[model samples]
Target: MSTQPAAERETVLIRSARDVTELVNSGAARGSHAKMIVLLALGGIFLDAYDLTSLAYGITQIREEFGLSPAGAGAVTASISVGAILGAWLGGVLVDRLGRYRVFMADMLFFVVSAIGCALAPNAEVLIVFRFLMGIGVGMDIPVAMAFLAEFSRLRGKGSKGSRTASWSPAWYVATSGCYLVILALYFLLPDSQHDLLWRFTVGFGAVPAIVILLVRNKYMNESPSWAANQGDLERAARILRDSYGVDAVVAEDAERPKRESKPRASLHQFRTLFARRFRPRTFQALAVALAQTFSYNAVAYGLPIIIASLLGQGDLNTISASLVLNLVFAVTGGLLGMRLANSAGAWRMTFWGFAVQLTALVVLAVIGDPSSTAWVLLALFALGGFMFAQGGGPGANFMNFASLSYPTELRGTGIGFNQGTLRVGSTLSLFFFPVLSASFGTGVFWVIAAAPLLGMVALLAKRWEPVGYDADAVEHEYQQRLATPEPARG
Candidate 1:
């Protein structure tokens, strides 16, 4: 059942267009299949999303349970990001070195472990520790999954079916919304006095998707041939094609070509190579886009529950649930819009316009919102939420499109890992600092948060290059030509 290398494993060099075409055609098969993978892969993120929103849900309870203050709850909440930082740093290296299919399956183990730990935590200290570990797993999954989605979509084709599968990411937003709904359901079903189990069940239910994925993963998951070929593993590459597409068999001679003898794989150095001249500009672009998306998206969406909860001044669970549902709806709407635009408009263009829209929304939010007094604040929040989807979700929709296009096939995964790793760092920083900034600065702090999208707009404007609808080779060739030209000698 397994194609484990026996004795000495040989790399298969794929030289035929026929094989590559077949490989891609097979991948694009069912419009819904990619969605299934997205749901499965994003299972880890669903937990992260649920846990993140639920922290707000569970925070009130935790504060009471631990006899703590707001600062203590903030500390517990931020710890997950610290853990995610560690996970993001290392997860990229591990995923790049290991096959995507294998890592895809194995990484879930971390999520499972952390979930159990979170559910069983005995003290505030212990809860924070477990939550951080779970965050690490969550942080690592996004880049890998995005790479998988992009590659799978490209192999499948960039058409309706491909679009359908790619759009599965919005399902995560839906799933995340369901998480809050679950909390509301549990609140009504369970006795008010039996609140102890609420957080446990909310966090625990996150594992169900992973378990379902585990069962189906073996049957459907195949190592990406393009990824294997990039790693210089031709035999493994061919085997993947044989297993997955069945139509793209490499010829024996090409399949048996001698593998290149290269330097020992340096995951760390490869990680840094992302910022080298060849990759640096786009690396920064990808990072900025991700940062803009994350900062704006997290600031507005995650903060929505906090804002609504705080503003309503002693609202029922239903209000909190409604706020979360609204966040999910607008977020999914943005993601769907991004999916529509991904193929036609450039990712950077979508990013620029999205951020521009977001900036406008945030400005309106700052001008009109009186967190304490204004009912109009909710209207701004909804528009801001919808605008945010385009900003982050648009670029977030296409980080892989840019990353995959920027680097050569051989370094695609490494490039993606490093790029994503950088974004995760930014995300962690944003998550950690936003609350502090908000507390010290007040609701008007959104004005400061508003600056992030502007920065994204500046970065996008200064470095804009259209990458959509082009093959990797053509994009690389253009970059090489641009790099080879001698810059005018400085005076």
Candidate 2:
């Protein structure tokens, strides 16, 4: 060995997976390649939000075309959530077993095929089937996308892993706004007689973005270096570190290689690992935030158009314009703010405050009942906007923070998958029941929705777990160290 001091070594020596994890946690500045990887991951999230919302404005048109009852419409709307439930569960496992790059690439095809299928469906049955397929893509994409965001980022800084993961919220809001913009454009662009085809066009357009993401994925995306190291491929991890993260790392000549697993195993035991003693509090906190956030968000954001038109008594054009503005202005802005403050204010604090604001907004909307005057309508709209603002910045963005940062690379996929899968159940219920409940009790539905945020607050108070500024991956590092060290010889 050269007698050079460690600091004078030409390349940083990566001896084990712990070295790789520490390097990643060091928060070194990665160049544009890292940025592109993050962008691609965010692109997946954008597609997810876009595909889910594409039919939001067109739900009525679809109901009219199929001559469906509220229950049928609910089924059509909830199909994707149902599909997502399975997709998240399966995708979580696949992402861990198959690697992030492969699973991320595979999910885009689901988007492409499902979008086309939904676009071309001849009946409600076909639409529901295709929507369910699309939902699977949405569900699968989130875990891998979030994994990419977290794994690619540093542990602490202005744009740390927590902040970067929170970016999914703004990306989601941007996509939701993009859907509305498309609808607005199509509303005027389509001939008066061809207006009925708007939903088809909107749903079909999702395929374009999906295809674009798929094509560019191979060029920019790579297996996460940290993940590769954890899988016992230190050489591959070093190369990734050099290429993707601008770290001049090389596996030490005398470094011990990790024992590779015979196969990538994903099983029920992996799922159960999330509920292990050390992770139980994190699991419960993440689940609470996810369930509450998705339930309330799906109820409000998905039903915004309906609320504007049916409950708020706005015309179609006004409803579209208003929904678009609320998302772009309040939701997008709030998400950006949340992303910015994630490192400063912390995910736990932001999420609690966000739930507080959402509760207040829902209560206000509930009390307003029917807006008898323009002022009351404006107040109700303000309340809606406030809720969106809170969600965009708080739970909407930071839910991912809790889920993604609460585990190491080994369990990250499973943790996020479980959280998302369970939350989608709430999503399914909210989407399925919103129309029925709204129809039955009018604005009283807001009272029911208010409970979601309250539950989130309660969970937060009970758990007191804060993922921000915490090194969850340290657990894996410690475990690896223990394994590498020989056990003390028994006397």
lDDT leader: 2
Q: Residue pairs in steric clash, candidate 2?
A: none
Angstrom error at residue 451, model 1: 1.1
In order, what lDDT does every prediction score?
A: 0.63, 0.91
Q: What ranges in model 2 sit over 4 Å off?
A: 1-10, 262-264, 479-491
Model 2, 331-374: lDDT tens per residue? Answer: 99999999999999999999999999999999999999999999
What is candidate 1's lDDT per residue for 189-307, written digit by digit as tens?
99988876788777777667677777888667766666666556666666655565443345456343434455236376787777777678887887777677677666666566555
Global CA lDDT of candidate 2, please? 0.91
Show the lowest summed lDDT stretch of 10 residues, model 1: 4-13
lDDT, residue 173, model 1: 70
